[model samples]
Target: MVTAAADPTPQTADAQPWGRVDDDGTVSVREGDDWRVVGQFPDGPPEEALAYYERKYSDLASEVTLLEVRHRRGGASAADLRSAAKAVSAKINGASAVGDLASLDARVAALTETLSAETETEAAAAREAVDEAVKVRTELVEKAEALAARDPRTVQWKQASAELSTLFNEWQSQQQNGPRLPKSTAQQLWKRFRDARATVDKHRREFYAELDEAHKEVRDRKTRLVEKAEALAPKGEEGIAAYRELLDQWKTAGRAGKKADDALWARFKAAGDALYGARSERETADAEASREKIAAKRELLEEAKAVPDERDLAKARALLTGIQRRWDEVGRIFPREAERGLDDDLRKIEQSLRTREDADWKRNDPEQKARANDMTRQLTEAIEKLEDELAAAEKSGDKASIAKASEALEARRGWLRALGG
Candidate 1:
C-alpha cells in the first residue's frame, strides 16, 4: 500500500516547539497526519520564522491556560466562560500556529461541560432571590392595607399617616436596591399599596373637614357667650350671680381652636373681673361705714354687761330690755364677723339676767306657798297620831310596835320643819 510521503523537512537535533521553516521560505505546522503550510516570512531567518509562529502558538496556549485558571478560581461567570471556551476552540481548529491543539480543545470541552451545571445553579438561585423579594414586598403591602382598614374616627391620624409614609419609603428602597421582582407581581403590589394610600388619604381629609365643622360650631357658641358676658359689665356687682351661670356654660362648650378660644376667653374673663372689682369696692366702702355702728354697739354691750351682776333682778331685766330696743335701732353692722362678735357678747348678759329673774319668780310664787302650808298641816296631824301609838306600845310592853311608831313620828316632824311651819 502507498503511504503519504514523509515530511521533507527533516527532524534535526535542535527541533522547534511547534512550527518549522522550509527551504521555500514557508512555515509549516504539524498536524496529526502531516505538515501544512501556514505562511511565508521571506525576510526573516529560518530560526526567526520558526520563533514567530511558535510565539503565535504560545499566545493560543496562554489563552486556554488563562481560561482554565479562571474556571478553577471561579472569578468569571459560567456563561461567559462557556462563550470564551467556544471562541478558543474555534481558534484552535486549523489554527496557523500549533502546540498540542487537540488537548486545548479537550480542555475547553471539559470546561463547557462543567459550566452547564453551574449555570443551572446560578439561575435557580436568582429565581429564589426574586421570590423572596416579592414575599417581602407583599408583607409591606399587607401592612398598608391593614392601616387603611381602620375606622377613620378611631384612627390616630398623625401616627397612622407617619407609618404609611415609612412603609412607602421602604417599598421604594427595596425596589431600587433589592432583587427585581417579576413585572406582574411588582405591579400587583404597587396597585395594592396605591389603593391603600388613597383610602387613607380620603379618610384623613374627610375627618379633618368634619372636625373643622365641629370647631366652627363651638366657636359660634363661645362667641355668643363672650358677647353676653361683656354686656353684663354695666350691671356691676349685681350681675355676678348671672355671670356665674354663663361661665358654667362656657366650660361645657368644647374647644374653638387655640387662637379663637384664647381671644374669647380673654374678653369673658375681663367681664368677670370687672364685676368682682365692683363687689370688692362695695365691700371696702361698707366696711368703712360699719366702724361707727360697731362703736355704738360696743357702748350698748358695756351698758348691758352690768345686768348679769345686778343685785335687783327686776331692775336688771328693765335695763336689758331698754338696751336691746336701742341695739335694734342701731341698725345692722357691716362685715358680719364684727356684728356676730358683738351680738354674742350681749346675748350672754341677757341670758344671765333672765336666769336670775326665773329664780326670784319661783321663790315668791303664791301657789307654791299655799301648797307648803297645806302639807305642814297634814304632817302635824300624822305626828300626833304616831305619838299616841308609841305610848300604847310602851304600856303594853310590845317593843317592836314601839320602835315602828317612834320612827314614823320622827319622819313626820322632819317634813313639817321642811315646810317652814
Candidate 2:
C-alpha cells in the first residue's frame, strides 16, 4: 500500500531548457523570468553541465513525487505527510535543479492543504472514540458501585465478585486496545471502581466472619446434644423419651457448615438409632412372650363364631357375653397389629350379632307389630278402593283410569307383602 510520489512528464536533458552553461562554463537555473547562477562547470561542455545540474533536479523531483504517492495511497498519516512536505519544500527553494521547481512547490502546497483537512477529520474521529471509551468505562464503574451499594445480607457474594472480575477484565482490555481516555477521567473512574471493589470485599469478609462465629456456636451446641444422646444408649428403651426431647432441640439448631454438619448428623442419628434399636429388641421379646396369648385370643374368636348360629337371640347374647368375658381374661397380645386385627374380627362378629338381635327385637316387638298391622290394614283398604276403581274404569272403557288404578293396586300389594300382612 506504499506509494511513490506523483510522476511528472518525462524530459531528456537534450530537450530540457531549464538549465544552461555559459561560455565560462558557469551553470545557471531559470527562475521565472530571471536565471540564477547555480555552479561553475568550465571543464565540461554545456550539454554535460546541463546534464549534471538536471540530474540534481531529477533527485528533488523524485522526492516530491514520492510524497504525492504516499498521500494518495493513504499509507502514511496526514501529520507524517505534512512533515515530509515541509522538508521537501525547503529543499526545493533556490536549488541548482533544472526541472519544474514551481510545479513541485505547488504540489507540496496542495498536499499540505489536503493533509490539514485530513488531520481535522482524524482528530474528530479520535475524540469521538475516546468519548465512547470513557462512557463504557464509566458505565462499568457505575455497575461496580451499584454492586457495592447492595446489602451484604441480600447479595450473593460469589456471583457479585465474579461480575466485578469480569468488569475489571473488560476495563483492562479497553485500556490496552480501545481509544485513549483523559488522565483525570481515567483516574477518577478507577478510584470509584477500586472503592466499590474494596467495599464489596470488606462486606464479604465481615459477613463470613459473623457467619463463622454463628456456625461455631451451632456446631458446639449440636456437639453437646450429640454427646447427651450418645450417653443415653446405656438406658436401653427407657432412654427414648430423653432422646425425643433432644431430637426436638436438634430441629432448632442452625447450620454447622456442610462437612461438619454431615459428620455430626451421622453421629447424632447413630445415637438415635441405638436408642430405637433397644426398643425394637424389647418389642421383639414382648412379641415372643405374647405368642401363646395371641393363640388363646384366636381360639376364643373361633368359639364366639357360634354365637351367631343360635336361633334364640337371648341364648346368642348369653353365649357372646361369656365369650367376651373370657376374651378379656386371655390377656393382651404383643405386636399390637395382630391384636388390632383380632379385635376387629371380634368386633365384626359382635356387630353381626347385635344386628341380628336388633332385627329379632323388631320382629317380636308388640309396638312395631302393631304399627305394621295398622299400616297393612290401611293398605288393604287402599287396595280394595283401587280394585273397585279398576273394575269400574274397565266397564266404562276408560283405559287411562284403569291403568292408574292398576298401578296403585300393585304398589299397595307390594307394601302389604313387605309387612307380612
Candidate 3:
C-alpha cells in the first residue's frame, strides 16, 4: 500500500491528466501515471475543456464546500473566492441587468427633468401674480393719495373721498397679501367697491343740493333782517336798541356759502353802522349838555362845603340834603368829566365833615376808635378775598365766572365804602 506524500504534489498523484483538441473540434484527454504523459488532441471545445478540468478535479465540490465551511467557521478567509464568484456572476448576468438599470435611470432622469420644468412654470406664474398685485396696489395707492389731498372743510365731499380711499386701500392690500379667492369672490368685491363709490357720489350730490337750499334760506333770512334794520334806523334810542337786537340775531345765524356770507355781513354791518352813527351823534350832544349841568352842581357842592362851622346840626344836614338833591337832578355827565366832577365835590364835603366828626369823637369816647379799627380790618380781609376770587375768575377764562366774581367784588367794595374809610 502507498501512503499519500507529505507534500501532496500533483506530480506525484495516481494520475496526471492533460487536455488536448481532436480533429473534430472536440477535446480529448490523456492520463499521466507516475508523471509520464500519454495522449494529446488536435482541437479542444469549450465543454471538453471544462470536462477535462472536472475529471482531474473530481473532489472540487467537496474542497469548495470545505473552504466555505472553513471561512464560515473563521478558520480561513474566503474574501478572494467570494470576489471571484461575484465577478463571474456579473459577467454572466451583466447584459440583461444593464437594460433594466438603464431604463430605470432614464425614467429617473425624465422625472427630474419634468419636476424642474414644473417648478420653473410655477415660479413664472407666481411672478405674474405678484406683478398683477403690485399693479393693483400702485393704482389703489395713487387713488388714495389723491383722495387724501382733498380739503377736510368740505365735510360731505371729504368724508366720501376718505371712505373711498380707505376702501381702495383695503381692497388693494387684500388683493396683494390676503388669501386667494375665486372669480366669484373677485366679482363680489368689485361690485361692492363700485356700489360704495356710487353711493358716496349720490350722497355727495344730495348733500350739495341740501347745502344750496340751506344757503338760500340763510340769504332770505339775512335779507329780511337787513330790511328791518334799515326801516328802524331813524328812530332814536328805540331804533338803536332794536338794531342791536338784530345784530345779535345775525350773529346767531348759521354760516352760508362764502359769497353769501360776505355779502350779508357787509350789508348788515353797513346798516348797523349808519343807524348807530346817528344815535352816537345825538348822545354826544346830550352828554355835552349834561356836563354843563354837572359843572353847576359842582359849584353848588363847593358852596355847601363852605358852610361855616355851627352848633345847628339840623340846618347843616338840611343844606347837605338839598345839595345832594340838586346833584341827582343834574343827571348823567359826560363819561370823561363825570368821575372828576363827582370825586372833587364829594372829597371837599367829606373832608369838612370828617374834620368836624373827628373833633366830636375825640371829645366823646375812645370806644369809637376801637369800633372803626375792627371794621377796617374786616373790610381789608373782605377786599383781599374778593381780589383773589377775581384773579381766579380771570385765570379760568369763563365769562360767567368772571361776572359772578365782579358782583362779589362790588358787594365787598360796598361794605368797605359803608365803613366810611
TM-score of each: 0.56, 0.72, 0.43
Counted clashes in each candidate structure: 0, 3, 5
Task: Give per-residue CA lDDT, model 2, range 341-406, as digits (tens).
Answer: 999999998999999978988998999989998998999999999999999999999999999999
Question: On residues 1-421, what C-alpha lDDT tens digit does candidate 3 reach at each position?
Answer: 1111111223323433233334443433332222212223235544444354334333333333443454446532233434433443343222211012222233334434444555566667766775676456445545544444444446568666676867676886777775464566467556655664565566667778888998898888888888888788567556878888998888877777899899878888887788778868877887867768777766876768645454565566667668777777766666656757676766677567667766776646768777877888987898898789888989989789889889988887888787676
The predicted structure with the larger lDDT, 1 or 3, is 1
Q: Assess the local accuracy of residue 355 in candidate 1 as a C-alpha lDDT between 0 and 100.
A: 81
List per-prediction Cα lDDT, in the order shown: 0.84, 0.86, 0.60
TM-score of 1: 0.56
User: Judged by lDDT against the true structure, how good is candidate 2?
Assistant: 0.86
Worst 10 residues of 2 by lDDT: 1-10
